[model samples]
Target chain A: MAHKSAGRSALARVLAVLETFDQDNSALTVSRISKRSGLPVPTVYRIVAELLEMGLLERGSDRRLHVGVRLWEIASRAPRALGLREAAMPFMEDLHAATRQHTQLYVLEGCDALVIERLSTRSAVTNVTQVGDRQPLHATTGGLVLLAHASLHMQDSFLSAPMRAYTPNTPTDPAELRRILANIRTRGYVVCDGYITPDALGVGTPVYSPSGDVIAALSVVVPRDGAQPMTHVRALRLSSRGITDALGKPQVRHGPQNIRLFPFVNNEQL
Target chain B: MAHKSAGRSALARVLAVLETFDQDNSALTVSRISKRSGLPVPTVYRIVAELLEMGLLERGSDRRLHVGVRLWEIASRAPRALGLREAAMPFMEDLHAATRQHTQLYVLEGCDALVIERLSTRSAVTNVTQVGDRQPLHATTGGLVLLAHASLHMQDSFLSAPMRAYTPNTPTDPAELRRILANIRTRGYVVCDGYITPDALGVGTPVYSPSGDVIAALSVVVPRDGAQPMTHVRALRLSSRGITDALGKPQVRHGPQNIRLFPFVNNEQL
Candidate 1:
């Protein structure tokens, strides 16, 4: 059934139309979407029309296509992102208030670290991360923390790939990266100085679910030359614990689920 | 074509399925989704399978399904929501910090106020609103403000219906509501006390796009029994203006376009 089409699923094609609109290209003509998605112009038009009718896609006053609020409304209802964010918010806010830096929450999405939420200050160090953005497992503090607790197979797959280097200080070699991951596992935290950008350093800790599975990573980005990043590690760990504790609460079960699904595993796997 | 099948398109059915998930019911069994969307269980399953394969939905640990991270990612990339939120954030942050209350940014979405972003303290007054949640035009300060500045046709159509009243203080009579909207239009801000919830008060102001259209509404929610809600009206107006000014900047143009598709319009013929 899977091999029926090297041509992607209709759903995938539909997603392709949505994926075409991003931070850089927010609005696109049907031709642009067609070219980007590699779908025929007629197909793009039909799909776009269907999506618009479904309120999954919308057209702007400029006659260009964009994502629809209905999509966001549906996505926002997702328990994993919004629920976890809701539970973590009070704690994240406490941490943010204390540090007044960049506070972020991330979860493992495939092999990459997906930032679910982030709060930044103008006076904080510069970082390339944004909410709903992704970063590699080897380069980010949050990614490394998640990678540290990930399944051995996931770790091996990640380390086997040639890690992209954002800064000279990033660990690209599999052996060295393996050692770093081990260290993170042992220390219960990961700190990367200038791994992503030259001017910033990040420290991250894991957030566990009720089952003690490391479901997400919490991190703080600070200027590389500023106060010891280690000092903030305690706060990060505390905030992570608070979030995890909140997740374990019955009230949180009533909150939205922010689960990320990987086809390779079913519910029983967790 | 429009009259076929209860005026519902295939796309509309798909949207209905998506819309069934909200903050209250983020994860749903296939049966629940089918029931909520009024689609047959078989059709819901088929479409949901496609949506799952497309990364728009994910199965949770409970074996139920929720909105997928990919959906949020795609929606976040929509220029209207993400773009407007990005430009509005710094200003929103400033407003939140200043007011120490719930500061929200909402755009008119299909005759309702759809909150795109919000920042609040944990101890702040309780609000029924959430990011991606929708409020009726007559119930929220933001909604009222947006409705006041809306086209005459929109105003007439909105007031023509029997509006749902959340609290006794909520104006159910069209004449009284009309006066309130007119006052908002004249005063340039709205101080709504116990309109939605008896314990909260809302202060709202309009946000304009570069073209001078009232593209969004900015509001602050505070405890009803605390200081007068009008005290924050000026601050809310300032922040709204600040967001409008920031949105007008040249670099802020390319944002997710889907967020800009406001759903509510006056269909006088209806």
Candidate 2:
């Protein structure tokens, strides 16, 4: 739901109008946007007109409004998204080719793992994750890897909240998840068996920035039946190292003491 | 340069500040933004502050400003961008694997071809185009194919302009380019030898939308020496057809009469 407040700033209104369009509601009529955005019809009209003129929005053939390519062109330059994506792409391709499964790149955003890029095969195991889709931190292997390297405060708060169990194997209990996270940090990789889907198993490893901080997670999803998690983990580590090298940073062998509880505390606001 | 006219609306000002960021200038200081945007320091500061609060802009560790992940997250939902990309990615990956070269997707933006998606191997032939980079319509295979399907008015205006010749083989003559475009439409593909750069050959084909209009171009670039352009063309046509089917559009074999000069007139403004 949009932040429905009186006297919201013009910028806030525009953001709300833009936010009204998402994966499920990619296109909407003016009235639908006004209803979803909680902005008045006239206000929505003015904002839409301005946005359309600026090429931030486009009118579809059916007269519904969709986000414009111009906006995407501008936003594609964001270093936080495409910059990281560019660095990880080649390695991800290699992993995808080797595994013939779903290879994904993720970053922590709020309490969710935001998938930025995913390479999927036509016959790969079912993966609910799509690019730009967010999954709960406790329900996905990529999220667990990121959470393990997250700050203590974030982990504590996250573990304090009640999390949904996507499958019976999903780790939702705070104490058990804490142990699992600690294990992931020690192993430097995670193998999640049917945490998100009963038929899928995911192997995840951290991708470090030039500053030696965990900036993202690289993972591959394979069929849980007859899955060899360690084999996937080995492949993941190799690709993760490749991504780290591509980022102009050499892979640092982290001893137990070098593993910080808050490697990305400054990188993301928890 | 950003529009710096006085009394611009708040939307325009916000856009101006965002526009100041490009691939070349991803990170900027407040003063640099002010100078590039041509806005007063106080105004720029206020706008920047609001944007920072909304998470549209982020401060890097170096204290310089960068485009934030939140902005990219929202913009990633643009159907005009990721939607098309999602449909084209599998086919693009297949093309990349088969050719071990640069596989790209382009759409006509203004008088240029805007690359929305590109897949490249680490040791592939040199490709000047990057994702999000714009190439002159007459200088690259993707651009040429898109230009061929453009409306008559756009083609006329584009040919009337002084075009840049990236290489000696680049087509700069209006009459020659017109003939090339006609050949492309008739053959449903084009082979560009050393057009954008020496020692590279690009083969491009049109990707049709569900409406039967040319929505984008799919292309692959390989080394020129002993390159088989027909083989690449066949691969590109297959991938383009796959993308068209993925878009829920059954591929229609276009006769010369069915190929309208203004097929995309309603699709794009120019």
Clashes of 1: 17
Cα-based lDDT at residue B108, candidate 1: 74
lDDT of 2 by residue, A79-115 (tens): 6678778778999998998989999999887788989
| Docking quality tier of model 2 | acceptable
Where's the lowest-lDDT run of ten residues in candidate 2 chain B?
B256-265
For model 2 the local lDDT of residue A197 reads 83
Model 2 residue A186 distance off true place after TM-score fit, in angstroms: 1.6
Residue by residue across B1-270, what tens digits does model 1's lDDT show? Answer: 111225665556667778888766777899998878778788788889988876678897778888877778778765556667777888787888777888888877787888888887767876776778788899898798888888889888889988887888888888998899889878889888888888888888887776667777888888888657666887777777876666665541211122233212111111
TM-score between candidate 2 and the true structure: 0.92
